[model samples]
Target: MKAIFFILFAVIAGITAMAITTEQTTIEPLLTEEITTETITEEPTTFETMPIVGDEYCTWGPSYWCHNKTTAAECDATTYCTNYVWSENTKGL
Candidate 1:
C-alpha cells in the first residue's frame, strides 16, 4: 500500500513540473514579441513652431514685431526684433 502511494505521488509531481516548464517557455516567446512590436511602432517627435518663443509676437519674416510692450524687452531678447508698437489691446500694424 505504501509503495503504490509513493509511485502515484512521484508521477503527479513529474507532470506538474512538465506543465510549469511549458508555461514558462510559452510566456517568454510572447514577451519577446511584445518588446519587438513596441520598438517598431515608436515614432520620432516633431514641432510646428520654434520652442520657448511667444505666440503673440512674430518670430520670423522681414516685418516682425512684439505686440505687448510690457514683455517687449523679453521678446526682443528672444526674437531679436526692435519694433514694439502695439500694446496688449492693439493688434497688427
Candidate 2:
C-alpha cells in the first residue's frame, strides 16, 4: 500500500509539472507611424537660346561679323575664330 501511494504521488507531480511547463504566448503592439516621400522634376533646355558652334565664329586676318555660310566655307562666322575675310559674296551671307 505505501509503494502504491508513492507511485501515485510521483504521477501527480509529473502531470502538474507538465501542465505548468506548457508553451506560453504574449501579444505585442504594432507600429502605427505614417511614411511619406517626394518626387522632383527638372526644366527642359532650348537649343535656339544657345550659341551655334560656327555661326559667328571666324579665323584668319581682320575679323568681320559673318552670318550663315556654307559648311564648306573656310572659316567660322562667330566671333570665336581668327584670320578670316568678310565679303558680301560670302556663301549663305
Candidate 3:
C-alpha cells in the first residue's frame, strides 16, 4: 500500500543522507630502527703532592690534624688549609 511505500522511501533517504555526512577514521603506528657503536678507552688520572702551608701547622686534633684552629662559630674552616708543619698527616721529629 501507499503507507508501506512511504516507509521504504523514508528509510532509503535517511541511510543515503547519513552515508554522505559521516566520516571514516583509521590509525597506524610510527616505525623505528636500532643502532650500535664501538666503545672507547680512557687514561687514568694521577694526583700531585700538596704544598705544605706555613707556621700555623697541623696537629693530631679530634678528627684530622692537631694543627687546625677552631672558629668562634664552631665550624671547620679547613679550606684555607694553613699550618702544614703541625698537621696530623705528616711524620715529624
Provide the lDDT at 48 for model 1. Answer: 86
lDDT for model 2, please.
Answer: 0.48
What CA RMSD would you report for each candidate?
18.4, 28.2, 24.5
Q: Mind giving the per-residue lDDT tens digits that candidate 1 earns over 1-93?
A: 999999999999999999999999989877776456777788978868766755456454324435344454544542333334443355332
TM-score of each: 0.34, 0.25, 0.24
lDDT of 3 at 78: 48
Question: For residue 58, what is the lDDT in candidate 2?
Answer: 48
Which one wins by lDDT: 2 or 3? 2
Deviation in angstroms for 84 in model 2? Answer: 99
- Pick by TM-score: which candidate is best? 1
Model 3 agreement with the true structure over 1-93: per-residue lDDT tens digits? 999999999999999877766532121121232333432244557889876664343333334442334531133434433434334554231
lDDT of 3 at 60: 30
lDDT of 2 by residue, 1-93 (tens): 999999999999999887666532121222333333432244556565776655554432233344344422445433322235444454345
Q: How accurate is candidate 1 locally (lDDT)?
A: 0.60
The per-model lDDT (C-alpha) reads: 0.60, 0.48, 0.47
